[model samples]
Target: MTSQTTLIVASPSAAGRHYECRRHVTCAMDDAWWKSSRHRMSQVIKCRFLPPARRKRLAAAGTEYWKSQARKYCDFCKCWLADNKISVSFHENGKRHKENVKKHISQLSKRSAKEFKQKEKLDDEMKKMEKAAMAAYLKDIQNNADLTSQELNDILSNGEGSSKLVLVPAPEKVPVWHEVKSESGNYYWNTETNETTWDCPEVYLSLAEQEEQKLKKQENEKAKERLKQEQQKDVYKEVNARLAREKMKEKAVKQPELIKNKSTYTSTFGPAERATKPYGSWTPVVNKPQEKVDLQLPKSSKEPIPVPVVYEPETPRIEFNEKKVESLGEGPVEFKKRKFNNHIKRNMRQKTDDD
Candidate 1:
């Protein structure tokens, strides 16, 4: 009889005796054991599991199984079916198949609404062209008809009774505003429509009149601007006149004295007198004689005589007195002396007071 054995694995970290059995064998399932022998056994078992041709056949069968389960929709016939129904219909002949063909043909033959709109637009354009051609024919006939130079000028200039037209200028539009008195005692113009609160209708009428007046004022300003631009061609004349007047006024106000002096000098010594004078002489001289002259001398009873005063020299006075020698601090000492230089000096000495 042959014996059948079962392999048992254990981790190397377990500390136990190896168990022996008649039917099964146990071994440590450690990394060393796998590297030694079990790893090769795993590779051999994996290789025996599936071959290359079997794997390919298995992959193809799986794809086919998935496709058999997928949902199917017929867009042309507008229907949904399972795989079984799809295969059965593909094998069978039905009206749906013919309808799909007709549907595609109809899609190819049908025109869109956009193309119809374009065709209608083109028809309108052709009608307009026909009308224009008719108008041009009538215009050419009218142009060939008899027409005077005055008539032609009238038409060109858009005069009265000519076929040519003149566009009338549009009337100015003024905004009508409602007047409202606020709590602050100020009036404001309200653009929104509202019920009239005032007792007198004349107030609203007057407000409208005020708005019209404002619009007229704006028009007048525009007209004034146009006139001013037209007058700019001769602006220098007005500017020069204004500047001359300003200069004259400024000179009169700022230099009145100078103007007066110049006027008086000119009147006193005018160009006429200057022209009459010789070229070398510019100044004028006037001569006047003395009013009176007196030739008088001082009167003396006796003739004045020169006198010489003679005086005997004073006798030299010598007096011997006991002299006292005073001892003062060692320093420069000064002495006082009497002087008689003039009468003014004597008066000054008498008027001075010593402190």
Candidate 2:
């Protein structure tokens, strides 16, 4: 059973046709009315009708579908408005919206100017780099051309010289004989003959070898002269050090004698007495003995003297006898209670009064 019921007629009657025509007209009118109502509601500026400005939308399947999703959002004002002529016009004309739009435009202009400057700077740098690279490339090409031309000139000169029978001396061959020393002993190497032997080669010495030997002999002589000079320097330094030590000893010995000769203390005699004995001589003076005056001592009385006794006070001492005190156990005594924190109580009282 379908939820929708359909009327059936046995024949094609006028009444059936007229009923069909009336139903079609009613459906069309209802559809048109619904469309008009939806459009009118969308135009109304209601809180629920506005979408959030920062709403996240899922990516659509195609670019076209995504592009079609143009929500009524103001980028500058940072809010969603009704997508209608009246709401859009009113929001755009508001003071806050116009200020925000002006700020955005100013920022964009500043950013574009900064970007343009940076691009110009980059272009200048790139141009400089290109010019430097071209200069280097041309310089390298010129250097290569000069080298090639020199090589061609040398080849031409050689060709011209080959036409004449010029007496050219053959190149001097280098001696390949070398002496190798190892733990087993010295060995001689004749590289030209590819021979190695313990004994020295009997072949005549080449000019290079003779020159090398001469250089070695001169170097050895110079080294010997340096060693002799160094030994002489050491001897001279030792002699100088010994002389310095002897001079210092002599000074030390003479210093004590000089100090003994110089008197550091002042004379006790006055200037007149010193002038009288200016020859650094002083005579001992003897004085005559004076007559002694005799005085009689006061005689004590024969009566018995009475002695007076003096009294002295003693200090009182405090003694803490351990036997008299009670024993103190490991833990605190029960009588020893913690003292009250009066400072915290005072602070709390002050805070409470302030509050």
Kindly list the per-residue Cα lDDT of model 2 for residues 52-154, writing each as its tens digit.
1111111121111101112377889888776678889999999999999899999999999999999999798667656655655565577586865777789
Q: State the lDDT at 270 in candidate 1.
A: 39
- Ten residues in a row with the worst lDDT in model 2? 15-24
Please report how far candidate 2 places residue 6 from its true position, in Å. Answer: 19
* Candidate 1 global CA lDDT score: 0.53
Span of ten consecutive residues with least summed lDDT in model 1: 43-52
- Can you tell me which runs of candidate 1 are displaced by over 4 Å? 1-69, 82-94, 103-134, 137-355
Residue clash pairs of candidate 2? none
Could you tell me the TM-score of candidate 1? 0.16
lDDT, candidate 2, at 355: 40
TM-score against native, each model: 0.16, 0.24
Model 1 residue 284 lDDT score = 69
Model 1 agreement with the true structure over 301-329: per-residue lDDT tens digits: 99879898899999999999997879767
